[model samples]
Target chain A: MGKVFHEIRDPIHTFIRLDNDEKVVISSRQFQRLRCIHQLALTFLVYPGASHKRFEHSLGVMELAGRVFDVVTHPHHLSPEIRELFSQLDTDEKRSYWKKVLRMAALFHDVGHLPFSHAAEKELLPDEWTHEKITKHHILSDEMQEIWSNMTPPLRAADIAKLAVGPKEAPELEFDDWSTILSEIITSGAFGVDRMDYLLRDSHHIGVAYGRFDHYRLIDTLRILQAPPLDSKGEQSREPTLGVEAGGLQSAEALLLARYFMFSQVYFHPVRRIYDIHLKDFLCAMLQGGKFPTDVEGHLSFTDNEILVELRRACSDNSLSTSELAGRIIKRQHFKRLYERKPTDFQKNEQAALLIKQALEDKYGAENIRFDSPFQKGESIDFPVQLKDGSIESASSLSKTLNEIPVVKTEYVFIKRELEKEASLWLSNNKDDIIMS
Target chain B: MERNNQRTILLGMIKSLKDNKSWCGETHIQKAMYSLKTITNTPIDYDFILYKHGAFSYDLRDELTEMRADGFLSIEINPSPYGPSLAISESGQRLYDKYRENVSQYDPNIDFIATNLGAKGVTELERISTALYVCKKDNIFDIEECASRINELKRHVTIDLARSAASDAYKMLQEYEKHSC
Candidate 1:
C-alpha cells in the first residue's frame, strides 16, 4: 500500500498535507479548540466575510513555513558561504529532521490564544502573560509531551516552545545556532511565515485587496546569510539569518506595505476598535476572579462560541455590566463617534481631543465615555536585500517608496449613543476652548 | 542576596545619573544598565534579549515598577518626540544614597557608564548597546565583524551607523579593560 498522508483542502494554501505527527497534533483536543477561535475576533461584525478561524490559519502557516524551509535549505538555493556552514546537515535525513520540527512548530503556534483573540488579552490576562506564553505552557504540558515522546526522534518541547514565542519573548531559552535559524523561519521579525500566511489569508477572507502581496516571489527569493557583527569585540563567526535576494526587494516592499494597509483599513478600523473595547470590558467583568485561566485545561474549556453563548445569557439579565455591553453588541447599538482627529491634525489638535474627552466625561459620566489613542505606527523597516553582485544592503535605504509611507495615529472619542446629541452640541459650542491653535 | 545586589546596582546607576543632572527614558535606562553589567562583569542579574529597540529587560521594567510603588523612584510621562522621559525622584535619590554603599565595589564601573552614556539620546544609546549585545552574543571580536553583525541585526541602522556604534562599544570595552587593570 502506498504511504497515506492526511490532507485538508484550504481556501488560502489550496491543500495542507499532514504527516502522522502533524495529524496527531491536529486531532488533539487542544489543537481542535482553535476551530472555535475566530482569526479576527469581532471583525466579522464589520467585514462579514472575515469569519475564518485559527485552525485554517495554523495549517496555512505550517505550509508556508515548509515552503520557506525548503527554499532556504536546498543546496541549490543556498549561497556558497551558507552551504559550507550547513555541511553537517547536508544529508537528506538531517534536512528532513529540521523540516519536520519547523512544520510542527508552525502547527502549534496559536493553540494558546484566548476567546475573542487579542480583544480580551489585555483585560483577561496579567500584564506580562501573553498568548505566546500560554502557547509555550501548552506545548510543554503532559499531553504534548506524550506525543513528542512517541515521535521517532523525540522532539524537545523547549525547542518548539522557543520557536513558537521567538527570541524576544523567550530570550533566556537557549538554542543552537542552526535551531535559531530554523526558529526564525516561523517567528523572525522580518520574513516570518506566520505574518506571510496571515497577510494573504486575512486579505482573502476579508475580501479586500489591501493585504495582498507578492508572497510567491518573496518566498522564491528567500536565502540564508550571515549578518555582520555589531562591534569590533564581537565574534567573527558566521551566524545565519533569513534574508532575500535583490530581485525580491519589490516583493518585500509589497509585503510591508500590505501590512500597513491592513492595519489601517481592517485591524484598526474605528468601529472595530470600539467593539474591541466593549468586548474587553465584558470579558473583564465576566472573568473577575484571578483574571485568566492559569492552566491549559481551564483555557481549553473557553472558545469563541462559548463566550458568545455566555454573552447572550448575560444580555437578558440586564443587571450585570457585562450584560449591558453584550446587549449593545447583540442589538447593534454601538457607541457613537463623538469626535475624531486624523494623523495630520494630531500634532496641533491633541490637546483639543483630550479636553473634549474630559469635558464630555464630566457631564455624561466616565462610564459612558472612552478616549482611544493608539500609539504612533513605527516606520523602521529593516530587511537585508542581497544584490546581484553578492553584496547586501538594507531594503529601506534602497527603496524611497518604503521610506515615504506615513505612520498614522488616530484619536477618537466614543460616547454612548443615547448621549450623542448632547455631546455633539457641547463640542460644537466649546470648539474654541477644546481645539487649541 | 543576588536580588539585593541587583537592586543596589540599579539604585546606584540611578544615583549616578542624578548626579549628572540628566534623566533618561526607559529605553535609555535599559541599554545603560545592560552596558554597565556587561562592561563591569557585575552580577546584576537581568535577562535582557534583543528586542525591537535593542537589549530589553522585562525584569528591569518590573523592578522599576516595584521601586516606584515603594517610593524609591518616579517615572514621569512627559510627552516627547521619542516617548516619555523617566526621571529620578527626591525620595529615590535618598534611597540610592542609603543603599549605594552596598555596591561601592562597582562604583567606578557605574560612574564610567553614567558619565559616558548619560547625556546621549535614546536612539544612539540603543544602537551602541545593541552593538555590544550582538557582538557579545555572536562572540565576534573584530571591529568589521561587529559592525556587520549589528547591521544584520538592525537592518534600519546603516553601515556607517553600525561602524560608529561598534567604535563606541570598542572604546567602552577599552575603558573597561583599563579600569579592570
Candidate 2:
C-alpha cells in the first residue's frame, strides 16, 4: 500500500499515484521501457511541448480509470444500487479487473501506433496490420505472461489479457466475464476513460486547448446505467445500456467536439505527419532488415530510451540512418506540405501512386514517395449514454450537434521527396495530373 | 479580359486548334483573343491575353522538353514554323485534363484560365516530332517519344468519346490544349 504513493507527474493530471503492487509493475524494466515511448510519438516535432513519454501517459490513463470507477461507485453520491453492485465483486477480482483495464489501455493505446503514431501506421502497414494488433500481441505473448508472474500481487496476467481483447478471441481465459463492459468503455462509447485521459493529457503536453474539458464534471456525472446479468444471454441483452449517465447530453456532446478538435488541431498537424513518416521509415527499414534485437522482433518490449539506443546501434552498424534523420527532426526541419488532393478513384489512386513513385525514383535517384491513406476508415466515436431509466442511447442519436457533423475524411499523404525543388517544379508542371480533385 | 474569362476563351481556342490539327500560331492566338473578349464580355487586355495564352512569359520549348525528360508531358519540345508547337502525349493529355479539373474546382470562376496556364506551363508537350526525331536520329531510340506520339495521334484522329483515354486524362488535355495554341 505504501508503494502506491510513488508519484508520477503528468502534464494533464499532475501527480498520479502508483500502488505498491502496481509499482512493482511500473518499476519493472518492462514497464520502465515506456519512458522512451513518446505518448504522442512524432507529435513532438509538430508540437514542441508534446515530448511527453508514454510512461506518464499510461499513468495518467490509469489514474483516469480509477477516477471513473470512483465516480461510478461513490457511496454517498452514487445510487445505492450501483454501489451495492460493485461491492458484490470480491476484492481480488475487482483489483484484477481494474488493473487489467488501466495497464492494458495505457500500454495498448499506442501499440497500434508505429514509431510515430498514425504516420508510421500508414507507411509501414497500410494494408497489413494495425498498431492495436501489435499491442494486443504483446499483451498476449509468453513474455507478458512472464512479466505477470513476477508481480508481487500475483495477478493472472493471462486473464487480464483475455479481458483486454474480450471473449471473442480467448473465451477460456476470461474470469470476471466483464469483457464486453470493459471493451465498450475502453475502445468505444463516449465516456470511455481512454479518451477522457488522452484528451486532457495530450492537450496539456501538446500545449493545445482542444483537450481542455470539464474532466471533473465528467467524472462526477458517471453512474452505471445497467447491471451485468447473471447469465451470458442476459448480459447480451443488457450490454448496450451498460455505461454512466452524468452530464447527460451536454457532456457527451462536448467530448465529441473535443475529439473532432483534437483531430483537426493536434493529430492532423502537417509537421507531426512529417515526423511520423520519417520515424516510421527508420523503424520499418530496421524491422524489415532484421536489425531489431532478437527479443523485440514481432514482439516488441523496450522503453523509449531502449528504442533510441537500438536506433543508435543500428546506425552505428550501418543498418539504419536514424541519426541523420533525427538531426533534421530535432531541429524541426520538416517536409513541405505540397498540396492536399482527394483521390478521384480509390483504385486509380493506388495505380497512379505507383507510377508517381516510379517517376520520383527516376528523378530523385531512389524510393521517395510512399502511398498513404490515413482517412480510409470512418472512425466510430459513438459513446453509449445510459438513460436514467436504465436504457442506453448512443450519444450520436441523443445529441443534435453530434449527428450534424458527418464524418468527412481528408484522405491525402505527406510526400518526402529527395529533391524538393525539382519535385515542386515537377508538381507545378504536372499540377493538373498529379493533384487529385 | 479578366483572367477567368481569358482562360475559358483560351481553352476553347485550344480545342479548336487541336481540332484543326494546326500548330499554335497567329490564327490560334487571334481566335483565343477573340474568345477571351467574348467570354469576358469586355475588351480583353493584350498582356493578359499573351501571358495566359503562353504568348511570351512561358518558354514552351523548355517546359515541353522538361516534361518529356520527366516522363510527365511526354511531348517533344521543338520550335515549329507556326510559332511554338505542342503535341500532348497520352501522359501529357492525362496530366493536362487532371490539372484543368483541379484548377476548375480550386477556383471555378478563374479555373478555365488557371487550368490553361498550368497546362501550358506543366502539361503541354514540347515537340513530339523533335523528341522522336532526336531519339530516332540519335539512334538513342527512347520509346517514350513514340508512345507520346501515339497518344497525341490518338487525340488528333480519334475523339471516339467512348475510346478516349479516361475522362480525367481527356479533361486535363483539354485544358492544356486550350493554352497550347
Candidate 3:
C-alpha cells in the first residue's frame, strides 16, 4: 500500500496532516500529554470559550511551519544571493529531509510548557531553567531518542531541540547554516510560526477580532535574504534570514497590532489576571513539597486536568491552603480591584504608585493586597523587510504605523473582595497622593 | 531614582560614550557601566552578576532592546571576527541632552571609564571585566588573588593572561580611586 497520510480536523487551520513519522511523534506518550494542558491557562476562567489545549495548537504550528518552509525555500521565491546558496540543497531528497525537521521542531516547541502555561513558571522552576530548557530536556531524553531511531531517515534530536529553543537559550549547541535558517522559520524574532499560530488560534477560541490578521498573505510573502556585513574588511558571507516581501508589510503590521491588542484587551484583562494570580497561589500551596515534576514520567503525571482534580480534592479537605485559593477560583469569588494605575499615570508617578502599594499592603495584610505590574512594554516587532528593489530594511523602519503604536503597561492593586469597601474608602482619600507626581 | 529614570541615565552614559567616539559592542558598554557603578557609587541598579562573559545583566540587555526600539540606539552586526557594535542615534543624543543635568553626578566616572576602556578590543575588555567581577564578588583586592580567581572562573585563561587582566583591573581601580579623591 502507498504511504497513508492522516488528517486531523482543526478549527483554526482547517485541517492538519500528519505523515507516518509525524504520527509516531503525535502518538508518543509525551506528545499526548499536551491534550490535558491548556493553551492559555486560566484564561478560560475569564473567556469561557478559550478552553483550547496545546495539542491542537502544536498541530497548527506544525502545519503553518510546513507551509512557511515551502514558501521560503522554494527555488523561484529566493533572492539571487540566497538562491545561489539554496542551490546546494537542490535535490528533492535534501529538501524533504529539512521539511521534516522544521515540521517536527514546530510540533514539539511547546511540549515543555508547565500545567498552567507560564503562570507558575517563575514560582516553580529555577531561575535559569525556563520552559524552553525543559522542552530541550524532553526532546533529547531516551524516549525521544527511541522515537527518532524508528524514523526512516532518523532525525537528529539536537537539531529539533535547537529549533524548539533559540540559539540564545541553548548557546552550547552549534547548528549548521541550513539548520539555523530552518530554526529561524520556527522561532525567529521576526517570522516565527509559534506566535503566528497562537495569535490566530487564541483569537478564534476567545471569540475576539483583535487577534485576526492576514497570516495567509504574510506567509505567502515570506522570502529569504542576506543582510550586509557591518565590517568593511569582513567577508560578505552574511547568513540568510527569513524576510517578507514588500507587499506583506501591511499584513505584518496587522499581525503585530493584533498581538498588542490581544495582550491589552484579552490576555491582560483584569479578571483573567486575578484568576491567574489565584491559580498560581493554589499551585504554590499544593506543590510546596517539591511535587512539581521534572522528569518526563513525572511531568506526564500532572496536567491541567490533574491540577483541577487536585484542587477539587483540596477544596473538599478545607485544611489545605489550596482550599481557600482554589475555592475562590472554583466559586468565582475573585479578588476585587481596589486601585489601578493606567499606563500614562504609572509612567509619570511611579514612586507615588509604589507608596500607594506600600500603604495598602501595610493596612491590609500583605497577602490580601496583591500588586500586579505585568511587564507589557517593548514587544519586539523588528523584522527584515525585502523591498520591491530587493533591498532589506527593518520592518520598524519601513512602516510608520508600527512605530506609532506604544507598548501598554498596566498596574493594578487587588484587595480581597470582602475588604473591598474598606480598600475603596482608603483609596478615595489617598487618590491625590497616588496620582500626583 | 526609578527604573525609567535609571534608563535615562544609562542612555545618557551611552550617548556620552558615543559623543567621545569610543562606543563599542554590548560587552564593552556593560563593563563600562559596571566600572562606573563601582567607582562613583552611581544609583543605577542593574544587579549584575558573574555570567558567561563577565558582570552580565539580563535587565540591562532588556533595557538596550527597549532603547533600540525607541530609536535611541542601534546594533550593527559585523562579520564573523568582529562583534555587533552599539551606536547611539540622533534622537538618542537629543534624549541624552534632555536628561544631561540629572546624570551630571556620574559625568566624571563615565568619562574616565569610557575613555580608558573604550578603545580596548573585545578580548581585553572581557578579561578586565571578568577580573574586576571576581575581585568584587570574592572581596579580593590583592592582584594575585584576583588573578587566581579569574583563572578559576574562566577555565581557558592561562595564569599569565589572568595576571595581566588582574594587573589591568587593579590599575583601573587605583586610577578610579585617585580620580574620586
User: What tens-digit string does per-residue lDDT give for candidate 1 at A1-437?
Assistant: 74558889998778898888888899999899999999999999999998999999999999999999888887776777677656436788777877887888899989999987877586688778889888989999998999977886778788788887777667767544566677778876468888888889999999999888899999999988654222222232244567788899788889888887888788878888888888887777787573778588888989999889978888888777677878877777789888887433333443567777888888899999988865323223445567787765545556666555544456789999999998799888886665663
Regions of candidate 3 where Cα sits further than 4 Å from its true position: A83-91, A175-177, A228-239, A434-437, B1-9, B17-61, B64-181
**Candidate number with greatest DockQ:** 3
How do the residues B90-122 of candidate 1 rate in per-residue lDDT, one tens digit apiece? 666655565667778988888888988877665
Better model by DockQ, 1 or 3?
3
Model 3, A152-180: lDDT tens digits are: 78888887888887665675664434556
lDDT of each: 0.75, 0.47, 0.75
Q: Name the top TM-score candidate.
A: 3
lDDT of 2 by residue, A1-437 (tens): 33445777665777777656567656654456566667787676557788877667667767777676555544554444433434324476675556555555554444433343444554465353555555566665676667666665555655555444433333344222134445445543456777777788888877778777787777777665532221111011121223447355576567667877787677766666666666665666556552333233533453455556655565455334665555445445555654444345333442344455455556655545544433312233334465656554445445557544333234333456445676878866764564242
Let me know the TM-score candidate 3 reaches against the reference structure.
0.77
Q: TM-score for the second chain in candidate 1?
A: 0.89
